[model samples]
Target: MIITRAKEYCIKILSSSNCKKLPFHNLSHTQEVVEHAALIAKETSIDSEETEPIIIAAWFHDTGHSKTYFGHEEVSKELANEYLTSVGYDTKKIKIVLSCIDATKMPQHPSNLHAKVLCDADLFHIGTELFFCKKLLLRREWELEKIKTYSDKEWHKINLAFLEKHKFKTDYGQTVLEDMKLKNLEKVKTILSFY
Candidate 1:
């Protein structure tokens, strides 16, 4: 399957030396997004045909981090297009995968169901038990990049605002993950209060 081939390609790209600096956007993160995409696809009863692009998008969405972090989604989309075309994947399906990758960009806006699933899957950790740990890794990445160091309290407020502004676009995300996300928000709030 094209999706299977895409996954293998994604793994190879992510494991290459170019991705060594990506502490947070590593292979594990891509795998997690793939798992989340599958779960959301199943819960939403998305057919296999529709699910293919979503899964492929999930794998390639963060692969751009291998090259650069800023504007990574555009890079990811370009890379996805190059890879899918090289593999002789359907041009229409490649377009769908590109759209899904674009939907994963920050302040996500998904125009279709598959994009919605990809968006939610890409951010599934925001509601999971691993949220804090994953966030710490992101913080570390920022620090390493000298992007802007934040105090623990400052990070709490930033995280609080982010969580407050973020909304799960899909029914499955809202129903299954929204409450947990709210809890995570509250936890951040509580930490901020203590600070």
Candidate 2:
């Protein structure tokens, strides 16, 4: 299937020298996004054709992090366009995939259902048990890149504020994930209180 092919392409690119330092935006993260996108799509009753672009976007969303961290979403979009075109994916579907990737950008504001699903999938970990673990990896990635650093207490505060400001766009996300996310926010607050 095209999704499978796109996943393989993503894996291959991530394994190449170009993606040597991606502690957070690695293959594992991409796989997680793909799985979350599928779960969200299934829960939302999105059609198979619609799910295809979501999955493809999930695979390629961070592929540009292989080359650079700054403005990687645009690079991801370009790469997705190039790879999808080369593989003969339908033009309409490619556009959908691109929009999905775009929706994953920071301060995400998705314009359509596929983009909404992708946005929720990309940030799904904020509502899961693995949230802190994934967050630690992201922190480590940032430190390694000399982006920024934070103490445990500071990180807890930052996460709490982020959770407070963020909201899931999809019905499944709002109904299923929001509670967990709120619980996580409280957990972070509890940690901060101890500090």
Candidate 3:
């Protein structure tokens, strides 16, 4: 499948990168995104035709992450185009691919079906048991980047506030993923008391 090929390429990219600068953004994260993207594709009632584009988008979504520039979504799309074009992925499909990558940008609000699917897939980790673990890694990444660091108390407050602020936008997300989402959030809430 196209996604499988794309994911393989992403793996190659991750394997080739220096672990120091791109510690959190690695092959495991790309694999998780591909898995979740496929899950969302299955659960979302999106046509099979939409599947490859979404999956390919997910695969290449973070490929540019280790580059000198911090925000790598655009470069990821460019990378996708470069690789996919050589393999005969249509140019038109590349536009949708670009849209899917952009959908994952922070403060995300999907305005199209492709965007919605990609956004849902990106946030799919929120419903998983490892949601808290991923958040911790995110915190660590932020610390490494010198973006911000919080005390234990402050971190707990920040995590809880962020979780509380998030609401699922799609019916598929609301129905199937929402319960797990709440459970994940509650786990954080429970941990906060210990801090």
- 89-108 per-residue lDDT for model 1 (tens digits): 88988989999999988899
Off by over 4 Å in 3: 19-23, 193-195
- Summing lDDT over every window of 10 consecutive residues in candidate 3, give the lowest-scoring window: 17-26
Sort every candidate by lDDT, greatest first. 2, 1, 3
lDDT of 2 by residue, 98-169 (tens): 999999988998999999999999999998888988899989998998898998888888889899999999
Model 3 TM-score?
Answer: 0.87
lDDT of 1: 0.90
User: Per-residue error at 55 for model 3, in Å?
Assistant: 0.5
Q: What's each prediction's TM-score?
A: 0.97, 0.96, 0.87
Better of 2 and 3 by lDDT: 2
| Model 2 pairs whose backbones collide | none
Highest-scoring model, TM-score: 1
**How well is each residue in 52-98 modelled by candidate 3, as lDDT tens digits?**
78888888888877573367887887889999998998887888888
Best-to-worst order by TM-score is 1, 2, 3
TM-score of 2: 0.96
